[model samples]
Target: MTRRLLLSYLGLALLVLAGLEIPLGWIYARGETARFSQSVERDASMLAEVTEENIEEGKTAELPAVIGEYAAESGGRVIVVDRKGIVLADSGAGSAAGPATRPGTDLSREPDIAAALRNQTTVTTRTCTEGGEVLSATLPGSSGTTVRGALRLTYPMTTVTDRVHRVWLALALAGACVLAAVALVAFTLARWITRPLRTLERATTQLAAGHLANPPDATTGPPELRSLATSFTRTATRLQHLLKAQHAFAAEASHQLKTPLTALRLRLENFEPYLDPRAHASLDETIEEVERLGRMVQGLLALARLENTATTPEPVDLDAVVAERVAMWEPLAAEQYVALAVTGVPAGQVWAIPGALEQIIDNLLANALRVSPPGSTLTLARAPGTELHVIDQGPGMSPADRERAFDRFWRASDSHHDGTGLGLPIVRHLTHASGGEITLHAAPGGGLTARVRLRPAGPPPRRLARRPHTAAPSHGSTSATVPGERAGG
Candidate 1:
């Protein structure tokens, strides 16, 4: 933008200079030529009068010496021609003694001399055969009304041309100086105009990255730019306030409901022993419903806290996190007659919020266990680029279902599982907040693979000898200790 603006300014300067300098230069050249011609003609006329007097007094031989002297002083060539169109004397032949005729040097054939022979004074300019320009002036010599001869004066046109060239050179220099000044002014103005916009751009980027503590200043630049900055700052402030209110309401509501829900669950458990067999089954369902509601409230509160809190990243043990989560789910895997295994690097560190890795693994494992059939395998692996993958041999979702899988309260219709549907959405929000990514893809054979990429913080702590290892569920009917697994199971 600055370059374009400066170019436009220079273009206008060039246009204006061309408009003014061209005609003015031509006028100066014409005026100088006319003035020089007029002066030469006057000198020629005076010499003609002197020559006429000399002829009448019978001293025509002395005419050559006088004309030669005048020609030498004026830096010109002078020729004396009789009325018969023949050269009487030539100053350029050095002696100016007598009728000196050079081949092809007939004075009568020259335009200016021809005009003078007709009793008219003439001044003209022409290019010589030698490729230089000359100005010639001719005056008729009259002896008491009878034409005696013609006195012609010739001078090189370089004198007038050089003068005109010098004038144009000076104009060119002045125009260059003006253009330089204009370029400097234009550059300064462009900088002044864009500086504020650059500042605002940086501020806007920070805001989008969740850094809203400092807003752009509105007091710089022109009035329109200032107004734009002011509006942006106001909008950011309002958005910040509205988000704060929303988080506060979510946290407060979730925290307040926990006490009542816990008390109700305790009362229900105490009354369970007196309930009939049929009523017991209904009470168990009620208890499960209450637990599901409690988990939903807790999930909402967790999401709100994640939004409200700014968690600084730190190095977490990826291998350790996956191993621990799989261990906790091993009992449930055995009870379902499913195999749980882990592979890849056993000691890798990734940058993530504290406890976030554990929650992600817990939720993914829960979802896999609920859908995975007996004899199927659940594989947890750590790949390069700080990536983790959980592959389950279960019925996976279609492309369209996967696209909407991250939306809260969305579930597959063909699934036989009961879930609140907030698991994947919460995982997505948490992963994004920690500057990571999560994606779902079809497994190699059949089923789904959850791929997660987290930022690397640093190298893992050195441990003992390393070796490839895997964990599979033991043969038994059992249950596993689940962490944050209520929503998906």
Candidate 2:
């Protein structure tokens, strides 16, 4: 950005200098040349008058002396030619002004001299062999319309060229100074504009990290950016306070809500033995209701904690987690007389929040196991992409139910009444938080298939410890059911 801005400034400055200085320089050059030509022409006319009478009278002895003095003072060559096309006086060998030339030479052959003999004056610049360029002026010395002689003056054009060169050099120096000044000013302006933008960017990053210690410097830069910074700061302050209150509420409610419910469950259970034998069924049903309510609270609290925290994703071995979870759930499958197995090609590492993959797989397997018929099979499968499939040979849901499966407390019409409906919502929250996606579809052979798609991760470092291939028996039996399979698959 700074480079672009500086280049724009320099470009505009260069154009302005070219527009103003080029024409001025050209005009000065032409004017200086014109003045130089006029000077020589004026002098030629005066010299013509001086030698006109002498040449006509055919007494030219004093002519050479006059030409010599004038050429020495003016650094030019002077020639006096008579109307008969003969040179009467020449500033050649006697004067250090021009090449050696003898008197009585025909001068009318020269273009300027021929013109002058016709009673015309000519002024022009031309190339010369001895000198680079010379300005020559020829004026006729006529009396009463009769041409007596001509005076021809030749001066070097270097005098005019040198002045024009100096003017161009001066313009070049001025242009360079202007460009330098523009560069400095442009650099300052660029930095000024971008500094506040950088500040806002850093502030946004820190805000997303949930640790914005210092907000943007809204005191500097353009008014628009300053206003943006100020508004962001105000909003961030309010959001931080709201999140703090929510965290505190979840923490406090976790303790307050769990204790009383736990006490109530124990109270209800203790009365079971004292009740009449016929009332036992009612007591058991009440106890079950209390337990279900407790599970709902736990699921809700889990969601609250998830929402309040931000965790970065890390690489997890996809195949290893699937294997471990399958083994862990195999015992329950055996008890229910349902087969649990892993199928499909091996999936490699995938990115997920820490501890999230384990929870996601456990919940999905639990729900699958709950719905499977006694002779049915529960499969944890993988395919070409970075997606996992939990397919069960159980009754499948309609498309409408599948769409609303992620909604809190939503359940299929045929599902068990005991379902708390929080499971699928919890699963969704975890999946989205890890930057992955979850969807439900009908399996090929008529069963519900829950598919999770996640980002692939780079291979783990060789120096890292290897994960065990199988699930350890020490894992809690709670791994068997995804929130009692009440969790949505």
Give the per-residue lDDT digits (tens) of candidate 2, residues 1-489: 668878988999999999999999999999999999999999998999889877677668999999889888878888888887788887763232347568889978888889999999899878776647888898999987999989888888877889999999999999999989988998898879777788888888887766578889899988997898899989998988998788778757865788899999999999988999999999989988888777667666666666666656778898998888787778878988888778888889887777677778877776776778899988888977889999998877888888888877676777775667877776776677666799998999799889999878865322211111112323322321235443343
Q: Which model scores highest in TM-score?
A: 1
Model 1, poorest ten-residue lDDT window? 462-471
Query: Could you give candidate 1's per-residue lDDT for residues 257-310 as a string of tens digits?
Result: 988998999999989889887799889888887886776776666666666666
TM-scores for the candidates: 0.74, 0.71
Scored by CA lDDT, what does every candidate get?
A: 0.74, 0.78
lDDT, residue 259, model 2? 81
Clashing pairs in 1: none
Error of 2 at 329 (Å): 1.2
The CA-based lDDT of model 1 is what? 0.74
TM-score of 2: 0.71
